[model samples]
Target: MADNAPAPPPLYDNTPTISEKEDPSALPPELAGPCSDQAQVTEEEGVASDIADKEELPLPPDPVETVTVTVMESQLLQKELPAQENPVAVEAEEPKLGEETELKQKQKLGQALQSLKEESNNVSDLTESDQKALLELKQLIEEALNEFSFSSPPEKEKNLAGTLAVEVSIWGIPLLKDDRSDVILLKFLRARDFKVKDAFTMFKNTSHWRKSFGIDLLIDEDLGDDLEKVVFMHEHDKEGHPVCYNVYGEFQNKELYEKTFGDDEKRAKFLRWRVQFLEKSIRKLDFSPGGVNTIFQVSDLKNSPGLGKHELRQATKQSLQVLQDNYPEFVAKQVFINVPWWYLAFYSVISPFLTQRTRSKFVFASPARSAETLFKYIPPERVPVQYGGLSVDPCDCNPEFTISDPATDMTIKPGTKQIVEIIIYEKCIIVWELRVVGWEVTCGAEFVPSTEGGYTVIINKAKKMTPADEPVVHGSFAVSELGKLLLTVDNPTLKKKKLLYRFKVKPLGD
Candidate 1:
């Protein structure tokens, strides 16, 4: 009879996914795989090294104030890059040492771009095997595109191999456009550990899914604004990656829950909305090889509907499948804050769908540690006010300060009092904002003058602040004399509290 046709290429990775049945302890070491390869991980140790190098870079000190930098763990950190329309790995000129010494501060940012050039989109981030895989994947894609027409939309039915198609693009970048194509290609390669065949399959499948799902059209669709607060893109993480927060508790409202998941149609709409949000967010990222391409995902599970909520679970399952399939290597870290006891069950349900590398980026925290955990990855100033941070929404009426103001974060042990002293040597007015997450403590402020003759001013009388109190304290004082502002926090409960504050001193006559 005849030689059997060569085995058809697999449509998806047949590699067995990590199962809950498998040992779970081996995963979630906070992260073990983010920086292990070039395709992902710039937020942790690898990215930290970038920062460490900057910290070591000899630069002129600031004249106004010395900016304090916080470096958390050296482990891998993540923020997904957005698929930009014209993102490319730029070969920016490097700054010479001691060049523009006075403007050395500008060089810090330049060095960051230079470091990205060294770490990403170029051959430096790749191994011999990775290079080989990349070449193979590129060839396979050329063949597939020539053989199977793939475009953002307005699908072309003709599949001709006369040439490598430049018309086929993803995230608005062509398959053969430039180095950016390689950056996007590496994402698939790394997601499959540089398995050429698997990566090719993933590439094909992603294109196919985008078309089948009409993602291009979906992005422009208006699904409704009800879930606006449920999910949103906020500021960047410590590593400069964009942070996306998912407040699942917002669905706790019965009306919202029913509207989103009451029926199959509603659930489908929610999924579309979520994917739309993700597509929109991804477009905001820079896919330049060395750019922060991955997103930092923080899921707030506080007050999340429990396992009994069949619809929520089902929607989550579907969403996970879509994300895991089409959005490979898009997440830098998957953090679950204020995780409930049922979190294990939730993890178990989705565990089988994720890769070991993906799972390694996971971090979990209970309610008590939620805000603190975030503080490690995200600075207190960059975090949202509702999440125990100084960054207020633009719509809110905080005129004195914006998210740009840097804030100091510290902790006070139980049964102890910590005082923050801001010494003023000039005649100026000071505006300040402070907050203690879970305020089961007492807070007060006082002014002490350098001269013994200066009268002590009690700005805020020491009061026992409870969780019921407003989460933030804002105060302003007109300082005509040189003195020191002392803000004090006293914790009486057994639990420690996170303290965040920022202040600005306005020179007189300004």
Candidate 2:
């Protein structure tokens, strides 16, 4: 090691020495090189002094005196710089219960944080206020689940979950109709179930109802009438058994009611039904029979109208008298007599005998065969509320006939002696037999038949025959007409022909 080392401090006092002022730069060329960059430094300036102190070091490194020894120092940095070994891994980290508890808590805390983050992420799309509102709503719904309900439903009954109520109306009503066109009417009734369908069917089916003329039929050209208001007489029984009977045209005419019932109290009741059915006098009549007596009255009559009051009264009396004559006891007891019409509504009331005064008797007389029979069979009833009789004549009184015989000839004529003639429309055979003392004469007289309305006979020519028109026989005069048969017979001998004539004839028409 070279031991020659001496350094002096910078001297600056008074007007400091040039050497001192010059500092190290003034000392040697080698040292000046180091101080040259500080040439503007002043002596008292700390900045120059700082430069001077740095220049005091030797300009050259001492070579021979220094031994160059190379040394490497490595400190294993046992400095334990807060140990890079994770505190979690140190000393095998024997987990203290509290530490373990703390670790679990920390792990739980991490999971909670992670869960919170996930929930936050899920709600991130909502505004902050909306998220808060949704959370509150959820809480409210949860609270509601635990509260009581004012109108709570019971636990659902199995198999009956939804159906809970029903409404009912118009359950039972009966419908009646006639059989002639029942199926068409039934189709109408079903179609009427729907308002839309019903309107269409009513318009289409108007023709079926239009045939009704008063009680005979029910129909209206306009669609205003109610279906229920249209009356129908059920032609069949409830079980669909058809009632078999002739519904005569006369039965449907109002005139028949007048003819059958006349002005009797029973007639009033019958009229009441007629009015109730349609609120007017029977413009048309419809009848159903109750008994044989009623049938007898109607069976023989034609169904024409215009029967006058007097005519109706006479007919009713005759019909009642016939019934009474046939069944006196029945009339006395007021046993129901069958009439042409059905039972009147009032029959149910005034039935059975009331008293002798009001009690009614009916008699039925056999049909008249001759003028005498007509007189005997026609009479007023033995007991009566009213007295009247019926006779078959254009005039009020019945006709009379007389037979006169003189000497051997007999003249038979009507009471008025009117000649009646019948014109034969077709060819027919006619035989007239005159029974006188039980013998018929052959070619005994000439005959003349009238041209007016009856046959007028003039007996003129007389002839005697060997075999007379007698015994199971008669004088047969065959008349072929569209031509004429004339007979003129004058009894010139003035012999009385007491004759009882019986004629049999047949008219053949094709």
TM-score of each: 0.74, 0.16
Compare the candidates by TM-score and give the number of the best one.
Answer: 1
How far off is residue 182 in model 2, in Å? Answer: 30
Question: How many pairs of residues in model 1 come into backbone collision?
Answer: 14
Off by over 4 Å in 1: 1-121, 151-166, 341-356
Q: Score candidate 1 by lDDT.
A: 0.62
Model 1's TM-score against the true structure: 0.74
On the 0 to 100 scale, the lDDT of residue 114 in model 1 is 45
- Minimum summed lDDT over a 10-residue window in model 1 is located at 1-10
Query: What does candidate 1's lDDT look like per residue over 1-510, in tens digits?
Result: 000100111111111222312233322211111111111222211111122112222223222211222112112111212322111122344665744662564466346334442235575668877888888888888776766546543454544865533477788777767888888888777677777898788778878899899987998898989988877778988777788786656766899889988998998897788777777877777887778877777766555444456676566556655665666666666565664433344455556665545445556666666787788778777788788777777887378776656666776655567777676666777778889998877789887777877789899999988878888899988877777788888766556678887777665566
Clashes of each: 14, 44
